[model samples]
Target: MSKNKKEKLNVVYSTNPNFSYEFEEEETPETLDPKNQLLYVLLDKKQRAGKEVTLIEGFIGSDEDLKDLGKLLKSKCGVGGTAKDGEIVIQGSFRDKVIELLTKEGYKTKRKGG
Candidate 1:
């Protein structure tokens, strides 16, 4: 048996000659309209040596759409960041700017945390 087959759980061996493995696919949620999205912008300094990072959360959309939004924010802020796990993390403190940008894009944004 190949390493990949061995890694599959609950299937030691299939006696049936015509047996095939069935893999479940995850469905991505449809991207919501900008006006319908309620995004939260907040400043975080945890676990980064006291450096502040802006976190945008509460996004409801596909991964690709999330990534695209992240890219747009990074470019606008002229900073580096990442988008994953339904959150966007910008490298520095830019909460006001981020909220403004989101507003311009028709996304309902709220300031979160002091």
Candidate 2:
């Protein structure tokens, strides 16, 4: 007798006869080059509950990369924030410092919105 069990036809089993299982594959995030992308550094406080934040935009590629970069920036600035919608929001007006750091990291950094 074969010890190995045959592969299941469905990934999930349901008690209901009408139920069917469908599997969806998750996509891997793409890696992007820092040199090919232009990042914008802007200061914003319009809808942030009256707190100032530095916004980094125009990042191309994976959300994971964005989050990692956001973490790095937050640590460097000694603040807290979030990375979403392809933008990194740091909880402070660290525009100049952020630009400097990003430029040092080989990213094309730009200051936008005076």
Candidate 3:
């Protein structure tokens, strides 16, 4: 292994004057495809300053794919929102439209909340 890539397991510091530990970085898991992912479209209006937002959740994929889906949804709805924490937030209450879009993309979608 390369020097930079190889990590040391030596102790960095000892607080109890007896033992110490080293922190190691963990490997990231691969992202799943949209077709294999289960998504949900729901209408949310809480804590939004009286504005309604459509939320798409249950996504298990990479950040790039999430951003791509967010961009597509925003463009199709002609609005703006954010995609983070495995959820896509679309501006306005476009639950039906969001479901339509997601279904067309070969994703399994379910509508939650009224």
Candidate 4:
């Protein structure tokens, strides 16, 4: 090989924002144990008014407070519901909306069933 034909190549590394892009990492998740209780979420129908209900199960809170929160949510949503069987029964098929609201309220949720 000729000396002139062989040339050394220089490599460069950069950290410029305009030159590099990255998908933002998810912020640290809330500290909640999803085990033991079996977190579950579902959309069901209320016996009365045929109102769609968002059912959240496997919660790990006191019965009184859980019921209180359920009542509060119903009032906020301008609907009617109840807390029973260690689950929060909210009137409305607000699957995504409830998840968003609960996450803000420090509840870890997992969507269950289709």
Candidate 5:
């Protein structure tokens, strides 16, 4: 009935009085080295009311690292955006600038989607 009880849905009853439920936590992947990561920089405007945004994808790393990279890019480009779901979205069409910034940070970048 409670939140904790709902988690242990598999076991209706436990014979052992000392029985405890072990919850498995998902682990985030380690952040890869900048030079070893291949990132794609693109311009998108499909669902944004015709406004353009620069998207950086193909990043294999933890969420923290992704947010840090997004922060750096946003600050350098003087724009606002978000980093989530393994992608960084910058608030404007700055594909070339994003690629240059990523390159300066030692990341392998490729421009995409004209």
Candidate 6:
């Protein structure tokens, strides 16, 4: 890590588990609300074979803010990803990394399914 990177990391703090519980629960696609902190990264069957990153959307809320946040998450993971259809879709099984990023950003996050 370089000086700039270390400085940026200084801004990150340990996440409180209490604040993240609800957002981490497994939810049905129908019940998921646009305003929630929950993030879903669904992988398309056809796309799995050919890419290092996957498309994820359905984050909802302020578009500009979420998009920027998505980019931050992707970069922190050292991978490429995108934000679309209100979701932040990164290119790998980055559940733990995603969880850490979102939690640090003050959003409760969770991993669903296998």
Give one digit per residue, the lDDT tens place, for model 2 in 29-101: 6867888889999999897798889999999888889999999999999999999989999988899999999
* RMSD in Å for all candidates: 3.4, 7.9, 6.1, 18.3, 3.5, 17.5
Clashes per candidate (backbone, < 3 Å): 0, 0, 0, 1, 0, 8
Total backbone clashes of model 4?
A: 1
In model 4, the runs with Cα more than 4 Å from the true position are: 1-39, 46-51
Clashing pairs for model 1 are none
Question: Which stretches of candidate 2 lie above 4 Å from their native place?
Answer: 1-26
The TM-score obtained by model 4 is 0.57
Give a tens-digit lDDT track for model 4, residues 20-67: 323334343232343334457788764657767789887765666667
Order by lDDT, highest first: 1, 5, 2, 3, 4, 6
* Tens-digit lDDT track of model 6 for 1-114: 234433342335547655422222234343334346566554544556765454444464666677787888888888877776576778776776676666676665555555
Can you write out model 5's per-residue Cα lDDT over 3-112, one digit (the tens) per residue? Answer: 57556646878899899876545588999999899999999998899999999999999999999999999999999999999999999888988989999999999888
What digit string (tens of lDDT, one per residue) describes model 1 on residues 1-114?
244654555767899999877544558899999999999999999899999999999999999999999999999999999999999999998999999999999999999997
Candidate 4, poorest ten consecutive residues by summed lDDT: 2-11
Off by over 4 Å in 6: 1-36, 41-46, 50-58
TM-score against native, each model: 0.88, 0.76, 0.76, 0.57, 0.84, 0.55
Model 1's C-alpha root-mean-square deviation from the true structure amounts to: 3.4
Error of 2 at 43 (Å): 0.5
Whole-model lDDT for model 1 versus the true structure? 0.93
**Among all candidates shown, the one with the greatest lDDT:** 1
For all candidates in order, the CA lDDT equals 0.93, 0.86, 0.85, 0.67, 0.91, 0.60
lDDT of 3 by residue, 1-108 (tens): 243324647744458866644546655456787688889889988899989999999988677788898999999999999999889999898999989998898988
Decide which is better by lDDT, 1 or 4. Answer: 1
For model 3, the local distance difference test gives: 0.85
Query: Who wins the TM-score comparison?
Result: 1
Off by over 4 Å in 5: 1-19
